[model samples]
Target: MRDIHQVHTLTEAVLDPILAREPAAPRVTYYDDATDARIELSGLTLANWAAKTANLIRDEFGLSPGARVAVLLPAHWQTAAVLLGCWWAGAEVVLHPDADADLALVTLDRVDESEGVGEVAALSLDAMGTPVRDLPVGVTDFATAVRVHGDQFLPRGAGVALDGMPVAEVLAQARKAAARQGFSEVDRVLSSTPWDTTAELIDGYVAVLAAGASLVQVVNPDPAQRERRIVSERVTAQRG
Candidate 1:
């Protein structure tokens, strides 16, 4: 396992080490109240998804360093993979839908809003990774497209990170946020916070990675399930 303090980029520094040491340990656990769905991703599993997403961006989409990919998804495990994948592919993740992006990722409900993008992929956010059917002519189904991509990625360069921020800067912010949030390497963090902005992404998601902590992310959370979830997941920290 690589030393967390000695690492730099998000994937290379935080995730890769988990792959080397804790391949089977759960890194991210996701829940959706509306669908009554839950998904757990181990370190190696998350890396595989990130790598496939990277391959889809680089090989299938023909994107390279500095390319902007607009992401209009919510807080979920797939969103985590998408963010890491873009960084792994040396592409920047643009949060807004109309950011003049080369690639756009959105949910089915927002597909109509994806104008001016060179390419578009709609995610179903399905627990079973089902492909979205009946998509508009130009939209690609992320589940279907990503399944055909490779699971081992070698980035061509170290591109800019979220919203044009540098990788080092983002990772540094994550480290600080982890400390401020009282995160530790052994903590199992439970966060209901949405990664709607660059700040939230750093504070909520990246901090867990930086601190070598596990995350139990809940979207559209059910208050009644909160206590049960914490107990079931063995959560040690809480944040919203």
Candidate 2:
């Protein structure tokens, strides 16, 4: 077996394991109480999104490893694609608004109002991955732009280390914590936590990927629907 760390990119380490598993299995399911939206992604479908987004970042944006990208969207299933895609391109992800970034990704509703420090992209996050109805003046439609790219990517270079910790170290730490928390392939995790902090970074994103478990994410959750989701999704663990 090839060592994932030998690949020299965080994307390779994080995605390689998941790709080795059942591609047809459910990888992420998202529910939005405010919008009454539900979207589910199989491992293969999620990977396709990641690959296409990575190509967009690499080919269109001309961003190289270590370039920072601000992901200004909510915790929708599409956010998963963006996060994975950024790592796949060997770029760093910045969720904080104040952070410096070379590119900015925002929700379609926020496109006209957003002032990009550099390049801007709009994500519809709609059930059908539709393009925005009224695209902002300077923003590219993410769903439309990514469609032309192929569904396979190979990073051309290695990513730079962040704060003395490389991507490999981050993955290792998240995997260790996930293992200690009893997360595994057989478990289905329900994450109600907002993806706005460090804990959410490790627990919500990295841990689920590391554990090879499916994630059921709730955005603007409703208490009444929680039990129904837990039962329907076969959730074995809860995090908030």
17-83, model 1: which lDDT tens digit per residue?
Answer: 6677778999999998888888999988898999999999988899877788888999999998988
Off by over 4 Å in 1: 1-9
User: Model 1 TM-score?
Assistant: 0.93
Across 1-240, the per-residue lDDT of candidate 2 in tens digits comes to 443334467666766777787888889999889889888898888889898988999999998877777777878898888788888887777665533577888887655444645788888887787888877677898888988998898876545423334587778877986987789888889987776665567778778878888899998899999898899899998888
lDDT for 45 (candidate 1): 85
For residue 24, model 2's alpha carbon misses the true position, in angstroms, by 1.0
Q: Each candidate's root-mean-square deviation in Å?
A: 4.0, 3.6
Evaluated against the true structure, the overall lDDT of model 1 is 0.86
Q: After superposition, how far is residue 214 of candidate 1 from its true place, in Å?
A: 0.9
lDDT values for all models: 0.86, 0.79
On TM-score, the candidate that comes out on top is: 1
Regions of candidate 2 where Cα sits further than 4 Å from its true position: 1-7, 108-116, 160-165
Error of 1 at 102 (Å): 0.9
Worst 10 residues of 1 by lDDT: 1-10
In candidate 1, the residue pairs with backbone N, CA or C atoms under 3 Å apart (3 or more residues apart, or in different chains) clash, namely none
